[model samples]
Target: MRKLLKILSREWFLAGMLLAVAIASAAPNLGRSGGLLHIDELSDWGIFTIFFLHGIGLSTEKLKQGFSRWPVHLIVQTFTFVLFPLLFIALDALIGRHLPPDLRLGFCYLCVLPSTVSSSVAMTSIARGNVAAAIFNATLSTLLGVVATPLLVRLLLGSSGAGISLGATMLNIATMLLLPFVIGQLLRPVFGKWFAHFKSTTNAIDRGVILLLVFGAFSNSVADGLWTRHGPGLIAMTLIGATVILAIVLGLTRTAAKLCGFSPEDEIATVFCGSKKTLASGVPMAKLLFGAHPALGVIVLPIMFYHQIQLFVCSILAQRYAARS
Candidate 1:
C-alpha cells in the first residue's frame, strides 16, 4: 500500500490509471443508464471532504499576506472574471461560426468559470511567486464563482440553452463547497494543532479524495461514450486551441501585472492564478449550466486539456522564474 501510494504521489499516471479502472467498472451501464453511477453519493462526499480539508489546511496568515497588496488582487480578479470571458467571446465571433452551436456556447460558458484551488496554489509556489496570494485569489475566485459564473453564463448564453438557475447553483456551491470549508475554518482553533501534527495525513487524504472525484467524473464521461465522439483532428485542434489561449492569457496577464506596479513575485502569481481554469470547476458546472449535451462535454474537453497544458507549461515557466530568483 505504501509503495502504491508512493507511485501515485510521484506521478499522476497512477491516478489516471485508477480513473480508467473506475471507467471500466462503469462500462457495463453504457447506453442503458446514461453514464451516471450509483456511487455518485460517494463522489459527492469525497468532494465535500476535500473541500473541508482544503479549508483546514489554509493558513490565515498566508491569506492576510497575499491580500496585503490590493492592486494584485484587482488584476487577478479582472483576469478571472473579465479577460477570460472576453477571450471566449472573441473566439465565438471569430471561429464559432464553423463550430457546433452547443460547443460554441459551452466554450463561452467555460470561460466564465472560476480558478481551481489546489493547482493554482501549487503553480504559484512552483514559480517562487506569492503562494499565499495565489491561495487567497483562488479561494475568493471559487467563492465568487458560485455566483458570478452562473450569472455571467445566464447573461451571455441564456438564449443558447444554457439553463443556469443562478440561485440553485449558488445554493449548491454553498452547501457542497463553501459550507464545509467555513465549518473547517471555524473548527480551526480546536483542531489546528492536531491538524498541524497530522498535516501529511491530511494532504494524503486530500489527494486521494481528488483522485476519487476525478475517477467518478471520468467514469461518467467514458460511460457516455466520450472518447468515441471525437476523432484525432478535432482532438488536435482542441489541444492547440487550449495552448494558444494559455499563452495569450499568460502573456497578457503578465504584462498587465507588471504595468500595475506589482513586483515580480506578485506578477507570477497574477499571471498563473488569473489565466487558468480547471476541470474540477468546469465539469460539474458544465453539467449544471449546459445540461448533458455532447457539446457541453466538448466545451469541457478544451478546458481540461487547457488545464493540463497550462500546468505543464507554467511549471516550466515557474521553474525558470525560481531559478532567476
Candidate 2:
C-alpha cells in the first residue's frame, strides 16, 4: 500500500490514471446492452476547460525567456514538426505496407502532433533543466498543432489516397482548438493571478478534465464494438511498435542535443520535451480528422498505447535525470 501510494503520487501515475479513464470509457461500450455514462458532452467541455486553465497558468515572460535562446528553440521545433514526421514517413515506406492502412495513417498522425504542456514542463523541471524552455516549446507546439497537424495529415495521408476532409478538419480545429485557445487568451487576464496562486488545485482540474475525456472516448469505443476488431497479434504488435518508437525518439533527441553541444540543462529540456506527443492533442485530432468513420477507434489504438508508454518511460527518465543532476 505504501509503495503503491508513492507510485501514485508521480506525474506518470496521473497520466496512467488518464489512460485508465480512456480505456474504461471504451470498455463499457464493448457490450451490446451496456448501461454506461455517455460523457462525450462532458469530455468536450473538459477539453476546453483544461485549455482554459492552461492558458491562465501560462507565464508569457517565462516563455519568452525560453524562446530567446533561438538556436535551441529551433532545434526542438524542427525535431517536433519536421524531423519526426519525416521519420514516420520513412517508417511507412519501410514496414507500413504490412500494417493496416488505418494504423499506418494513425502512426503518421501521431508523429505530427505536438509536445505535451504539463508533463513536459514537469519532467524538465524535475531534471533540473530548462523548465522555461519546456514551457515555451510545449505551449508553442500545441498552438501550432492546430494548423500543422491538419496540414501534415492532408499532405502525407492524402498522398496515400485516403484524403482527409480538409474543410471539415479545419472547421473542427476552429471549433475545438481556436475557440478554447481564444477564450483562454481572453480570460487569461481575469484568472491568471488566481490560477498562479492555486497551482495544485488547477492541476487537479487538469487531471479531472483529462479523465472525463478518456472516459467519454472509451465509452464511445465500447458502444461501437471496437475491441472485436483487434486480435492477440495486433495487441502484441502495438506494444512493440510503441516501445520501439519511444526508444528511437528518446535516443534521437538525446543524441542530437549532445551533438549540438547543448548544456546539460538545455539538453535535458530538449530531449524530454522534443520526444513527447500530446494525447490531449491526439484525441481531439482523432475526432476531427476521422470522426466520419466508426473504425477510427482502432486507428487511435497505437496513439493510446504510445501515450501511456511515453508517460511511463519519461517519468522514470525524469527521475533518473533528477538523481544524476
Candidate 3:
C-alpha cells in the first residue's frame, strides 16, 4: 500500500489516468461523442500536435541514423503481426469454448491491431529510449496495418476478400499525423533549438494528451456500456485476460531484445513497440471488419480492456526506464 502510494505521488501522470477514468465513469455522457466538450475534434488536434512536436524534437541526422536499423524494424513488425496474433489464436483454440463469441472475436481483433503510433512513440520518448527508431517502427506499423490487419483477418478469421476502402482513413492519418510530422521536420532547423531547450514543456504536453485520450476512451467505454452492461464477471474476465496477454508479450519482447544483444535504448524501443496494439486503428477497423454485427460493441470490448491495460503498464515501465537512465 505504501509502495503504491509512493508511485502514485511520484508518477502523477499515471495517477491522472486513474482520475480520468473515474471522471469518465462518473459522467460518461459528458466527455463522450455528442457530449458537451465534444472530445473527438479536441483529441484529433491533440494527436496532431504531439506528432508535430515529435518532428521538431527529432534531428534529421538521428532520423537518418535510425532508418536503416533493419533488424530492429524486422523484429518489431514480426512481433506485432506474427507472434501476437499467433498467441491469441492459440489461446482461442485452448479455451474458446468457454469464451463468448463476441469476446473471442474482440480478443482476436486486439491481437492483430497495429502498434499505436502516438503512445508507442510517447512511451519510448518518456523512457529516454530510441525515439527515432520508435517513430519509424510505429509509423510503419500503422501504415502497413491498412493492408496487413485486413489480410490477417481474412486468413485467421476466414473472411472472404473483405477489403477496407479506407481511402478516407488514410487521408485522416496523413493530415492528423504524417503531414504535421513532415512540417515539423521541415521547420526543425528553426525551432529545433527552442524545442530542445524546453523539452520538458513538450513532454508535459504529450502526457496531457495521453490523459485526454484516456478520458475519451473511458468515456466512450462507459457510454457504450462497457462496464454497466457487461456485468462484473465478464469485466473481470476481460481484465484478467488482457493482463495475462500483456504480461506474456512484455516478457517475450524483453527476452527477445536481450537475446538480440540490442542496446538498452533499442531494447526499450523493442519492448514498447512490440507490446503495443493500437486502439485508435483497431476500433474503426473493427467496424469495417464486422459491420452491423449486432454485438459489435461486445466484439470491441476486449480492445477497450487491452488499451487501458497497456497504457497503465507501459507508463510504469517507461518511468522505471527513465529512472535507470
Write down the lDDT that model 3 would get.
Answer: 0.78
Best by lDDT: 3
Candidate 1, residue 54: Cα displacement in angstroms equals 1.3
Show where candidate 1 strays beyond 4 Å: 1-9, 13-37, 197-201, 207-228, 287-299
**Lowest summed lDDT over 10 consecutive residues: which window, candidate 3?**
159-168
TM-scores, each model vs. reference: 0.85, 0.86, 0.71
Summarize candidate 1's per-residue lDDT along 1-325 as a digit string, tens digits.
9998887778764466355545544562431224345444565676677678777777777778778777777888898899888898787778878765545665676688888877888878877888888988988898788788878877777566445667886787678777888988888878877889887787677666545444544455555555666446666767777787888898999889878888888998898889878666665555545444434445566776777788788888888888873
CA lDDT, every model vs. true structure: 0.71, 0.75, 0.78
Collision pairs in model 3 = none
Q: Residue 209 lDDT in model 1?
A: 56
Among the numbered candidates, top TM-score falls to 2
Cα RMSD (Å) per model?
Answer: 3.6, 3.3, 5.0
lDDT of 3 at 303: 72
List where candidate 3 sits over 4 angstroms from the true fold.
1-9, 100-106, 116-164, 254-272, 277-325
